[model samples]
Target: MSNLIQPGETLRVLVFGAHPDDCDVSMGGTVLRYVQAGARVQFVSLTNGNKGHQSILPVALAKRRQDEAEAAAAIFGVEKYTILSHEDCELTADLATRRQVTTLIRAFAPHLVFSPRLCDYHPDHRATAQLIQDASYIVNVPHWCQNAPIRGVTPVIYFVRDSFRYPRELRPDVLVPIDEQLDILLTALCCHESQFFEWLPHDKGIREVPDADHPEERKAFIRKYWLDVRKQYDRNRFFSCLQERFGEAAKAIGHVDAFELSEYGNQPTEEDMEFLFPFPVYRRETWKTTGQRS
Candidate 1:
């Protein structure tokens, strides 16, 4: 069967991340775009995000992060949100975990899978990436995880954008314009207090962090301080890819999401991308109403 999903047919997307808010930070806007197009999106955090907070203990932080994940998932109206019990900074893509990941892929039978690249900074992120890669072929083998039915066709896998100039930089196969619904991403991030409001600021050595408790102030801080930093990375690194995909419109985009095609999953053609990436289905009224869900 062709990987291209028809307009009337609902799209199923499964996203795996190392930490609780990784999916929200990485692809929140793109996920909103999918849900707007009537796609069923599910987010899974491979780790419990226990080690992210400086003051909070591991067990307490893990529980707090789980609550934050549920809140953020509600913001996107995803089909489900799942958090695995793996220890932070200690995740391994061993055979047992690989089998578990394969079962997840087979159970959801996603049309496309979103995963981080094999490396960036975090060990958990790298392990999650390796997990997805290892499960790519096994997702189609019925005997691998006999309880869960096989996906039959391997889902096309895409690595979320990353910037690390070591072995090879990412090649942009898809560029998404998030200017329309950038606020939704921001609103979603507001749910993760420990990461956005506390730890990240301290980690960066920023003396004056936002009063993350206040809603209006928090939103403004996220936009001015955090998202702007991300915008710098995205613009300088991926503007050319945006120009390639979006042409003249790319010049005006304030926020963009970039993705790279993975060699392990089903290879999609240009036409297939039309269906795979639902940027064309975008409507101004569609996303402006996202607040209704929030």
Candidate 2:
């Protein structure tokens, strides 16, 4: 087998989200970068997103979200997109769920794992974070997830961007510019018809919904609405760190995604950050002089 399957030989990133579109909406751009850099990446939804739709039944909504997730994964060409059968709005970080998550981490044996932060308002988001955190260490224990073999190294865990500030705000350790991949990231999000073009707009209390028949108009609306939302989350944060990695090109970067290293998992050193995030090489060090940080 290739080194990708062997533990610690390759860089593997596995991202877990509470709902179907959560991973795509949060980390899609950065995951696309990882895929481009030949690192194996996987997106897993801890819940099936059954309760995401307002009108659709839970079973049908679950299926639709799974289909949407697969479509999005194809666009990014990631290795796996797994939507667990747990119902939405009801995720709990119980032992069984912890073992289930542990199995996934053991199966992938990733070097990097990302999930939502625990400070979020959503219960499922909090639960997903708890599950991943609980599994962070057990994934390396031989007897914990008995069915799945364990890897020697514990995967580094990161919290996907969140603006919540109850206990503390998210502290970004790595900031990545994804301007070139922004279109692809947006396109990947458009795959989640139920979430982006429909449910999210309705959830946000948008009065005028995008027309379903006009795919082009819907896509355009999706782009504009999400881009506006993204600006609030991504556009204005982390200039100093981005400049350090990306050089002065950080100023021109209209779109970006960030990761906050979690205290529960492996603490990555600077070298690990360089290999894991790989922004300069992604653009092949194009800004060799002026745009580069002094």
Candidate 3:
């Protein structure tokens, strides 16, 4: 069967991330676009984010992150959000992990699955990527996981971009313009209070402190940090990728989410990508008219 989503069909999408905030940080805009288009989307975090904070205990931190993830899912309008009970930074692509992934794949039976790239800076990210790849084929096998029903076909899979600059370069096959969705994306990402307002800043040695107990102060701190630091440093790479693909018009694209086709899953054509994204073609033409190249 063709992997193209049929007319008027609601696409079922599943995205896997290493931690509670990974999916939202990486692809929140794309996920929001999917939801706005009426697609059913599910986000799965392989780890419970137990060690994400500097001060919070593991158990308390896990619960806080889970609640934050739930709040983010609500913001994104995601149909389902799950955080597996795996410990932070300890995920591995072992047989047990593969089985758990396969069971989820069989249960969700998604049309498209999103995973992190293998060459990530974090161990859990790399392990989650490998686990997803390993489980893609077995998801269709009838007897692989007896607890879950078998899926006749494996979902088309793609890898979300990572910040790591090693092993292999990222070459994206699809670029979804997220300029209009930036506010929504930021809103969803802000839901991950532990990560954005606490852990990340601490990890990076940024001195702008976050008061997790004070909601208004936390929001202000996160906004300042994101705008002054994260947006320029991290998000610029995404814009550069877009400019490479879409030319100077891509500069008009304030933000974008990129994906690479994974070899371990069903292959999709250029037309399939176009169908899946469904962004305005006129934006490209508009770039030609007013862009620096033209």
Q: Summarize candidate 1's per-residue lDDT along 1-294 as a digit string, tens digits.
A: 354455576678999999999998888888999998888999999889899877999999999999999999999989788899998888999998898888788778788999999968988999999999999877776577787877564687889988776788876666677777777778888999898889988887767666756777787778877666665467657776666656787678877677877778877655555667776522122112221111
- Model 3 agreement with the true structure over 18-76: per-residue lDDT tens digits: 89988887788788888988778999999998998899999999999999999999999
Clashes of each: 0, 0, 0
Cα miss at 237, model 3 (Å)?
A: 5.4
lDDT of 2 at 25: 83
Error of 2 at 113 (Å): 0.1
Better of 1 and 3 by TM-score: 1
The runs of at least 3 residues in candidate 2 whose Cα sits more than 4 Å from the true structure, single-residue gaps closed, are 1-8, 212-216, 244-247, 281-294
Between candidates 1 and 3, the lDDT winner: 1
Which regions of candidate 3 deviate over 4 angstroms?
Answer: 1-8, 210-248, 280-294
How many angstroms is residue 187 displaced in model 2 relative to the true structure, after the best TM-score fit? 1.2
TM-scores of the candidates are: 0.89, 0.88, 0.84
Lowest summed lDDT across 10 adjacent residues in model 1 is found at 285-294
How well is each residue in 7-69 modelled by candidate 2, as lDDT tens digits? 445678898999988888887888888888888899999999999777999999999989999
Task: For model 2, give the 10-residue run with minimal summed lDDT.
Answer: 284-293
In model 1, where do residues sit more than 4 Å from their true spots? 1-8, 281-294
Query: In candidate 2, which residue pairs clash?
Result: none
